[model samples]
Target: MNEPMDMEAVLERLKEKGLRLTPQRVEVITLLYQLSHPTAEQVYSLMSKKFPYVSQTTVYSTLKMLKDLGLVNELTYGDRSSHFELTQEEHAHFNCKSCGEIYDVDVKDAHQLQYMLHAEQGYQVDFVRLEFYGTCPACAAGGKSEADAGRTKQ
Candidate 1:
């Protein structure tokens, strides 16, 4: 994977997409670029620290706008909070049950999967989300707290 993108490049891309470049929008984009997949509350909290005037509602709305413009993707694994990430690459996610960490898994057979879905189900799939839940190596080695066990499926 390439290095995390800079804010100027992100801002330029947003402008190309016809989005207005406001301070609130820039802050939200910066947080998303830096943190990868973060929940709205997480973005709001970080923005609040640096920008006391930035509101949660503004962040939420900005995220929605970015998503609509195909600049960002949203993921929800039935978790309490929705996660947002930049849509620069396509990959699946592995959610560790014990550590509560989300790892990006490269999809070597994405085209095959898409072909099978289209051939077998006759569904024109525009987007796909594949999540694998399991105990990561550290958690399996008893590194995580006991309370974290069995929280997700493998």
Candidate 2:
């Protein structure tokens, strides 16, 4: 993972976009900054604990505004719920099937791929998202144990 973002810088950027600094917006951005990629519901649940007055609609609208302002990125893994994360240096995502943990993966040749696509296909790619799905280390090891136990039973 890359270094944590400076909240002050993010706030300054938001100001430059002519967005007023509200408590709910600050809470949502802070949570996004801390947690890599969290669903809108996840963000609402966390914020509701401290700021119970904030509603889900407020969170959703705030996220949409932030995305439009280029402060946050909306991500999906073909799941029922969409996820949100603070925009950082472009990278890929790894979804663990067992643990349900989302991890960030840096793609070194992303620019090269973009260039090739534009040159060969005459395509203009503004952004790219790559996702890999698999069992993580803990889940893989646990699955092996289960398989071994099933063999013993047989």
Candidate 3:
């Protein structure tokens, strides 16, 4: 899995991609880096509190741009709203069905799996999605779930 990226490097990438560096965009990136796997609505709510002039449309547009630029990853849930994170490494996800939490899971043999599928099954590999759904530890303990716990597990 990927580590925390340097903001300066991210800015450089933005410049390389010909994306204008704006205050709103910076805040959006910071928020996603700070609060991993946050929904667009969650971002809009917090951004409104910090920068009242920042609109929901701006947040949506910023997220869209970030996704298109591969600076962020969008984690979608079947039963709940989608979440976004700055962790863009090739890792799998674990979704807690009971508590609605998403955990990052690193697949050590992801490349091997792709190779096996392509060589053995004659299936072309494009993108792979690996996610596990189950009850989190805190949910098993009847308490709030900690995102760090999931991160540590991986």
Number of the top candidate by TM-score?
3
For every candidate in turn, the CA RMSD to the true structure comes to 4.9, 7.7, 3.4
Work out how many backbone clashes candidate 2 has.
0
Clashing pairs in 3: none
The parts of candidate 3 lying over 4 Å away from their true place are: 145-154
Please identify which of the two predictions, 1 or 3, would achieve the higher TM-score against the true structure: 3
**TM-scores of the candidates in the order shown:** 0.79, 0.81, 0.84
lDDT by residue (70-94, candidate 3, tens digit) is 8777877665677887746678877
After superposition, the stretches of candidate 2 with alpha carbons farther than 4 Å from their true spots are 1-5, 142-154
TM-score of 2: 0.81
10 residues in a row with least lDDT, candidate 1: 145-154
Against the hidden true structure, what lDDT does model 3 obtain?
0.77
Taking the tens digit of each residue's C-alpha lDDT, what string does model 2 give over 1-154?
A: 4643689988998898898999998998888877757778878888999998889999999999988977788886555668787778888877776657666788788778989999999999998887888875757777543222101111
As for lDDT, the candidate ahead, 1 or 2, is: 2
For each candidate in the order shown, give its overall lDDT on alpha carbons: 0.76, 0.77, 0.77
Flag the better candidate by TM-score, 1 or 2: 2
* Ordering by lDDT: 3, 2, 1
TM-score of 1: 0.79
Winner of 2 and 3 under TM-score? 3
